[model samples]
Target: MASWSEAVEAAVRRHVAAAGSPFTRQALIDAELDAIVADVGSAGATPHQTLSRELQHLRDMGLLEFFAPGVYRWAGSLDEPMRAGTSKGVFVVGSHSIYQDEPERFYRFGPQWLPNASRIAGNWIIYQEPRRAGPRGYYAVAKVERIVPDPATEGMYLAVIEPGSYLELGRDVAFQFDGKAVERGLLNPDGRLNNGRAVQSIRTISDEDFNRIVGLGLIEDEDLLPRVDDPMPARVQEEHIPWEGPVDRATMLVSRTVRDRQFRKRVLDVYDCRCALTGMKLINGGGRAEAQAAHIKSVAAGGPDRVTNGIALSGTVHWMFDRGLISLSDEGAILLSRKINDIEGVSKLIYPNGRARLPGGVSRPDARYLEWHRRECFHA
Candidate 1:
């Protein structure tokens, strides 16, 4: 008993939810043409014309963005079933998981999540590790550049992480606070959790809820590190206070102030506050670290704000490294550029073994980024 337009809208939603967005007009026809062909029976309008009309309806409703003559991008939230210019979402990541998740690089997901994933394209996502996975709860956040089919595996897709956007939370936030579910969307009428919502690997998050998580995760600790350009070193003390105020999600994620704070925290934690080149752990009388976190590939060059793309260095060494006077090999060997006028002075600053001190595992500097520095910035 549905009208032709109603049936067309239903079919289109199903097709897009399953197939994802940024799709061509022909692709939609191919997936949904036959499903609603009956709706146009005995009418002068062809099924193709009917589908096109409904697509235009969706565009007018602000659910779709027309990119060209035939291409369209879905700009609606799949979970909430609403339209918006941008949407925020959550990604459930597990340690040693089945899906390939490079916390700072990309996230791999199956076809079932295409709709939810598309909702957050070109937007931010909060990364959480389930209790079963590890101690880190809502551990980090990153932006999704785009969604593309995984070349290595059929039916799988990758949400490419935006460069210089990934940042580990200053501290892990627990799922429940005072035995109440933190995510309001997951709470049932009786104050119990809707387990069905909790199990989803990809889900949309309300902006208010997203902001709350950011506040809890990135609360300033007493021992905050100084920014790269700070004239004076941070004075540290032994105190930690939980943030109990509202945070504007946009300001927290997009502002340079928060990005630098989160980036510095991740890099320093990875290297244990030691200079990678000289193996020095210098702390001033007030307890502020003299070791500075340097971008292996800088932000200006589209480098990611990830531990893999960062290295800790002393003040003088950081200046030299930033100026193309020094670099690092994939294997952690120091590479001094020909531009250095005082080789002996620089030599004394480096480790005696002539290798940069690097941590093992995923925290090590990524070779691709190091290669970029050698190719684009390093003098020789």
Candidate 2:
């Protein structure tokens, strides 16, 4: 009887030498084991049982991970799972395994000895006309053809490509898929999957591809791809408020950019969705009209890009407040900048001139940034 280590090494070498194109476990039993055992003078003429036992022992030692039943691969040595933050998020480490049974589903199996595989399954994104009804959802399953990151979204994450999404092959031609496009029988069809019923599958175009398409005049800015956090400012009446002192154009530009999408949501969440300027509450209509994230110290002047440095303001008040035309005192009083009083034709703008609403149970703005804005940006 050969030593366990020697037997395992011999088995691995034999498995490799056969050079099967689509390597399957049965191939090992059919060719390599019989020849190797005959040469090794092993007592057992048939080495399939011995090889199976040895492979199981190797799994116990953590050298390999079983992605699916009877499927194995090298376990990454140094990778370990890490906690994301104080939030209930976790980061996992695993390998990208291409399933041979179902090609559409891509799976990532963790390195733990469990009965079932723990993995992130591919989901289908269905596309249909706006009011059209049917099975409108994405189904999660194990099998993936391609994975790429979406740059337009805030957090960096990968999206698995689903079949049937439009693909442009040449300058003026496009191809669409109806069936499992990639190689079939690559993944288990009945395995765990995520079905995205409401999410629509739009064809993914890479940034580079988009630039090329734009250069060719295939699409325009209005038809540009929708980002994950694009902000559409609801239209409101413009207020022409008089300023008592000089207005700062640079400061106003900086402030406007800060109110853009990236910093808006966090600021709104920090402020509990109430307008700091008017304390206006829109409990109905999904709270869309009342509150918005307003930058305390404008993005142009090096203010931090986060909720800690933002204030929630109503749509009407945010415009008047941002143009260096208004501000808030440390005592939380409304301070209409002198620019407001000095400028001609500015008195018509509706200004929240008295007690300003402040966010509940939140820390006040940093004095340094606020002072900088007041000294450099405030019209007064």
Candidate 3:
């Protein structure tokens, strides 16, 4: 009969050994308790109840965090020396559940983890809905392959991670938890809806459940929230200003209005309701959906402020592409500059094989823009 603290310490050690490293609570269940229960006489211990109690105790001590439902790991163990030869453990966890009333909006929970320190990942769960499509109950996981700050919106950042990583993490968590942790909602079984319609109404533990769990010491509160900043008012490109000559202020204002509207519509129609580069769809007013029109060729470069020269892009990708950090080929393939690829983890931006999605009616990219990108922007 081991004491409670002694039993917990021993179980933690055994669980870590079996997992080959520190792992979440589910890992403990999968690797140790399930088998330990069946093998009675060797250790002659009640491993299941003992491990659960010990985990609860640890949670109360503020040393662990529940990143998602039933998923947890060490939360405050930094300051100790890094384990020999191991990269500093850093991971990003994003979880989403859908609402029944407003299917477009998704409740998102994301937290960053540092192997032994306070989880540094942003904590605030934001309500973001897909822009192009309604809530379809699909979810993904990816590493934070890139983080780009928004120039127009202070404190707003864009993150690009491997899509495959997102899918893999979703699958792994689903498999390990036997669907208890993730609820993808009821499928129609008739398969009546389109491909994206598979996820109708996914639900997870509610906010109350989340707070209760946290209160019980099941998770940590880092108080990190998604920062939202309003976009700056649109401005004419600096180069386009005729500063050397006497300016017709009234004429300029009228000309700008017509051009801006034309550009906006063309970009919207060309993107066909989503970002051309990232495939981010738009949602209505609910902070959950987003889609913004973008210019493929700079307005400052004599590109017509019309659909023929515009593209629809998600707000984030638009900023990057406009800055010449990302581009598309004439055939709608992704093009990354050699300089971009040189950055750590930038390969994730390649999108598997350089594929790009264009609107059905729009012609291929203009040769002039493609040439310009190649000459001035393409890393080559």
- Residues 219-329, model 1: lDDT tens digits: 465355574356643422223448977556756676555666677778888888889899899877777788887888888877866678889999899998888888888
What C-alpha lDDT values do all the predictions have? 0.74, 0.40, 0.40
Across 319-364, the per-residue lDDT of candidate 3 in tens digits comes to 6677677777777877665655454454453355658777554234
Which numbered prediction scores highest in TM-score against the true structure?
A: 1
lDDT of 1: 0.74
Q: What is the lDDT of residue 77 in candidate 3?
A: 34
Question: If the candidates were sorted by their lDDT against the true structure, best first, what order would they fall in?
Answer: 1, 2, 3
Tell me how far the alpha carbon of residue 209 in candidate 3 is from the true structure, in angstroms, after superposition: 63
Q: Kindly indicate the candidate among 1 and 2 with the higher lDDT.
A: 1
RMSD (Å) per prediction: 10.0, 19.0, 23.3
Model 2 earns a TM-score of 0.31
- TM-scores of the candidates are 0.70, 0.31, 0.32
Task: Give the Å error, residue 108, model 3.
Answer: 55
lDDT of 2 by residue, 11-83 (tens): 4433543352224456656755643343233536446777778667656867545656666664422122111
Higher-ranked by TM-score: 2 or 3: 3
Consecutive 10-residue window with the lowest summed lDDT within model 2: 81-90
Deviating ranges (above 4 Å) for candidate 1: 1-86, 95-106, 131-133, 145-154, 160-163, 219-223, 227-247
